[model samples]
Every structure is written in structure tokens, then in C-alpha cells.
Target: MPDIVNHTFENMSTAQPHYDVIIAGAGPVGLFLACELALERCAVLVLEQAADPDSPLKRMPFGLRGLSAPSIGALHRRGLLDALDLHQRMKNPFVGPSSPGAKRPAGHFAGLVFHHEDIDMSQWPDQPDGLPASLLSEMAELETVLARRACELGVTIRRGAAIAGFDQEPDRVTVHAGDETFVGGWLVGCDGARSIVRKAGGFDFAGTEPEFTGYTFSAELSGAAALKPGRNVTARGMYLQSQPGFIVLQAFDGGAFHDAGLPVTREHLQDVLRRISGSDVTIETLHLATTWTDRARQATAYRNGRVLLAGDAAHIHSPLGGQGLNLGLGDALNLGWKLAATVQGRASEGLLDTYQAERHPLGARVLDWSRAQVALMRPDPGARALRAIVGDLMATRDGATYVAGRVWGLGTAAVRIA
Candidate 1:
């Protein structure tokens, strides 16, 4: 890795600071991309709107994210995998049926458990035996590790500096953040779903509406025994009690409750739980709660002039199979080297354009994968019938292997620079 602090550019204005790349959002994707660019000796600056990165939602239970094979490989290749200790401290949080001699659950699809024994490793000859298919990670912890690495590589990060907007010229991009302005050769948006850069850049976002409003919360329950352990797909919707207090629910309300932007009150959660679970389980106290929906969307174009989008800014879907983070990380990994090469005047003709060419279709597939899960999880008789059929298929060796490949991103094509 090259240190970018002392790097100098010839014939560049010295009156004000100018970075090779200006990235929006200090989340994992942005920071990781910064580290990648800095590794290639490109000066990078990351701007974040949030003053504090710490949030309860970024901790245990709610912050839990699964690292796909590509994500793990990326980290390992960058030597950052050793810095993450969360996987060692915590076991897999996804719970399923437990019996004395039953196979251990590896992962799930729409609350359907796929055991480790069912996944035929012989089919995936490319993946080595020792390498993990997936690993559990916390969002805050992952961000901390990436941010630390980014700073070590001389990437400048500005908190409390949200990108109000930016104007792109032929040679450079002028960004407006707070009362200050910064100039960069290029800008990338990692600012999440509600990205100012994507909107300002005029990228067309097109997708389907949500099927249900999902809830993840930690609360004290009076009659918790009424709710079964692991995931239960009732006639109404889906509910999973991963632990004693931590609960996840999918209410097929057509995303009304989440889209309404109402606070998750204890009364409201209790009502939703009762209706979905068909149980009189009382939420005694609400500790923490957040809402999401299966509303899948993707930007029609990832790049608009000097502006580019990555992570949630580029695409968003349900967190059903935990592919969002991995997909975003993959985008950062794929774009970082290409963009850095372009910024350094080392890229061949149209090299930077390949970023979207490769990533956009992959993103679209993940969106459809989430949408399919939403379709299967629908609270209808047809969906239930399909779910049963899919469940049976998932139990087979070939089917389990195929689903694992998709879930772990093992089937993603490797793009190599000539």
C-alpha cells in the first residue's frame, strides 16, 4: 500500500486542496473504496453527513450482516480480514430448528433454512474447502475496521460534511458541503439509499414497490413463549425470534406502515406481532426498533458524467438474504481499482466504463433475487404453495448448492484487467 499524504500532482492549483476522488458517505463501502484508491496511490476524501457514526442499530442484533464469499475474499486479499474479530466472538445469529442429530443450518432464503449438510461442496470446485462461504459481521465493527484502514492509507474523512450538491466540469468536480467547497477529479456516491449525489446527478432509479413492511426490534415480551423459536411463516406473514428479546417480523401490509414513516411504538408493534403471529404476545417494553421493506430499486445508470454511485446509493432491495452489503462491497472492490487507474491517467480507453457494465447486471440480479423472496413470502395460498415447493427443492443437494452459490456470490464472474 502507498501512502497518499505526500503525493504531489504537477500543474495542479495549490491555493486549495484538490483530491483525486471525493466520495460521499463514510459508511463501509465509501471507506473501503477510499482504502482501495489510496492503496493505488490516489488521494481520496470521504464526506459524511452524520456527525457521529455510533448508533444502536449498528450494534448487535440489528447490525448483524452476513459476509458473502466475495466479500470475505476481498477483505482477505486486502489484509483487513484479520482486523475483524466479531465473527470469532459471535456465532451465527440466524436460528433454525435444533435437534440432537440434525444438520446445522448454514443460511436461509425467505426464512427457509438450508443446512450445511445439504450444500454439496463438490459442485463448487472453485471454492476451496477451508474458506468460509459466509461470515457474520456487525456494521459498526466493519465500518470501524475499514475507516481505520482508510485513514492509515491517508484517506481524508470529513464528518458533519454532507454533500449538498456538486457541479461537474470537463476536468474536475466542484462539491458543495456545508459552507465549504472542495474540488476532485471525480466523485463517487456511497451515501446510502437517500443519496444527495445520485439525485443531484440525475440518475434514474427504477424498481418495484414493496410487498411488506418488515420490522427488527429488541423488546421485553410478557408472553414470549407463544412465539416459537426460530422462524415461523404463518398464514398472515413471517416472524422470527432469533433470541430471547430480538425479533424480526414481516407483515404483508404492502409496505404501508414503513412507508407511512410512523414511529414503532410498543402498542403498534404488539398489534402487528399479534396479528402476524396469531398470538397474544405482549411487547412489555420496546428497547430498539427499525423498519424496512422489500421495495427493490436500481439506478438505470451507475455513472453520470464525473459522478458515480456505489452501495445503497446505486441499488437497494430487501435484506432478505443479506446480499446488500456484499453487493455494495463488491461494487467498491470492482470500481476502486478501475477509478483509481482512470484518475492516475493509467487506464486504457473505456476502462472506467466497464464498472457499470459488470456491476449493473449483478445488482439487477440481486434485486430480482430479493423480489423473488418477497414473492415467496407473500401471505397468500399461491405463495405458500410455491414456498413449499421451493422448500422441497432447497432440501436437495443440487438445489442447495445452487442457492448457496447465489447467496455466497460464488458464481460471480471474475473481471481481470489485461
Candidate 2:
């Protein structure tokens, strides 16, 4: 049966590029949707410009390490954890190490992976790991699992196949990826911010560009002695105790910081870490730095004709709260089952259309809420004072608990269409 889908893909003779469903992009969001659709017994094809999942070409270091609790909850509700072996798999190449430099060992340190009622930044030494539970997988590990899962569920994935253009008819979509053509009953764009799918589908992205930009830095810890004990520091940030302030261990995926809106460089970053941590941390794995301008934008809609949008293709904003990947996957889950049910004739056709109605607003709200988060990260005196005030207030016994729940993304929902 799976080979059947593969044969369909290779058998296409540019006959208007057909598919039961075609997905543009192979990120976790798109891959997960493909997995869901395939599980539901839908014939699905995913077209990615990259090569195979295991290829070094697709190897990208982790940066968006923060995953919201709500996303975890959603995945749990779908029984995807045991199905995907998420916990065990998440432990695969687990997201980070305290500092980049060589410490006692790699992937060491354990304890305290949770945020508590008291915003006690000084509670680090007592509890080692820093949080109770974190979305432990690095981006690469997560993507690999999702890709394999999608393929296992019978999704025909064509790597190095980029969608050049697309046209949507009432009941199907025609996609042109390089020299290959694919036809599908439904189409979705998961191609990140610069989505050819959205443009080809003719749906305008709606939302405001936020005022901040965040940076993800990857560096290795050279001196083991300086920062040997990474996780035993105060709750000042993510990295570890031994790491210098300039290069924080907060974003363990990479020993870096989001820096709200400030533009920074390798030299500047190193300098900042020195100033903050009071350690002249040597840089080892200066892997890659990605800067994304925070724009609190949302798609005016998630659907147009027979095509749909998911992940960064649908909306993008600050990566605050580690929400980008999680949000996109959530959108896919909601849309996938509904679309699959409709495709199988198990639900009204209108069920598929409700995807946009419910999710677009939620995406926009997340954008705005993230913008507010950036506002607090700003360094201006007034902004710092404001943040302190807000942080202090939120740190209040009740306030901290309430806001923590929301930060975990358990506080809201999109309206369901009847």
C-alpha cells in the first residue's frame, strides 16, 4: 500500500501534477500533518526542497528549543507520544548542554525542569536540571522522527523537490515543483515565512510585523574547568553556572539568548556574555546564527480554495515561549483530522473549511501576545522598569501560577465551528 503511493508519485507524467493531498515543506508541522493524514489512510505526498532526513544537508542545529506545555498537552491528547515514542525519542540527542565549552561531559546535568510559583532565580544549585519537563528533542531529532513517521504512514516525500508554483481548483490543487508536477485533492503550504504555497494559492498573509528580532547562537565550550558545572547556577537564565554571562545557557539548543530586538554579532555576543556572566567563555562550536525579525503577523485566513497553510507559512512572529513549531503542529492536528474526516466522507465538507475560521484568530492573538513579551525583553530604562514591575507582579503567588499556566499555553482555545 505504501509502495502504491510511491508509485503514484513517480508515475506522474506532468498530468497537471496530481495527488490525493500535496504538502509543500517537510518541517515538523508539515511532516506531522502528513503522518496524521496517512494514519487516517489518506494518500498524501510531501514535497521538500531538501534531500533525505538523515542527509547531512538537512542537518540544522537546534535553536527554537522552547516548547510550550500546551503543545505537549495537544500531542498527548492525540496519543502521539507513545505512537511517536516522543519521550524516548525526545531523549534522542536531547536538546542541549549547559555551556558550549567542554565540561565534565556532554549532555550532563539533571534536575529542576519546571517553573514554579516563586520566580526564585536563585534556586538553581538546589535543583540541577532547571525544569521538570522540557520539549527535550533538538530540532534535528524532532524533524527526523516526524519525517520517518510521515513516511511510515505512507506519505510519499520527494526531497530536493521545491514547489515552483501552484493552482487550486474547487476539488483539487495542481502543484509545480521544479520539473515535477503534482495534483492533489488538497494542498497545504508549510514552507516557512517565505511561502511559495501561500503566494501561489493567492491568499494574503495578514498581521503586523513586530518591532523586535531574535538571534540564536551556537558555540562550544572550550575550557571545561571554567564552566564544568553548567546546570548548578542561579536561575538567572538557561545555560549553566560555569558559563559566562555573555553566552547564556538559557537557550540550551545553542548557548545563546533571544536578545529581544537588539542586533548582535559574534564579537558582540561574546562581549555581552563576558559582561553579564563575568566569565571570558571561550567559543567552541560557533555553529550558526539565525536572526528572525519578530513580526506579530497572522494569515488573514488558513485556507483558500482547496489549499491550506500551516506553521510559519500561515503565520510567524517572535519565537518567544518556544511557540513557533508547537503552534504550527497544533494547527496541523486540528486541520488534519478534520480534513481527513471530510476526505473520507465521515464529516460534512464544511468541516474542512472551519480550519481557518478557528485558527486564524488564535494565530493572530499569539502574535500579539508574543509582541508584548518582546516589549518586556527590551532594555530601555522605562521598559526594564515596566518589566520588573510586571515580572514582580506575576511572581506573586497567585499571579505567577496563573501566568505560568497561560505561558504553558493551557489557557485558551479556538472557537469550534458547528
Q: What does candidate 1's lDDT look like per residue over 160-193, in tens digits?
A: 7867899999999999976678899999999999
Q: Clash totals for all models, in order?
A: 0, 37
**In candidate 1, residue 198 scores what lDDT?**
94
**Alpha carbon lDDT at 65, candidate 1:** 92
Candidate 2: global Cα-lDDT?
Answer: 0.60
Ten consecutive residues with minimal summed lDDT in candidate 1? 1-10
lDDT of each: 0.87, 0.60
Error in Å for residue 115 of model 1: 1.0
- Model 2 bad stretches (over 4 Å): 1-17, 52-64, 77-79, 82-114, 117-134, 220-285, 414-418
**What RMSD does each model have against the real structure?**
4.1, 8.2
The sequence of per-residue lDDT tens digits that candidate 2 reaches over residues 2-102 is: 12123233444555534568888888898888887887898998888765444332233333244555456555555554443245433313223434442
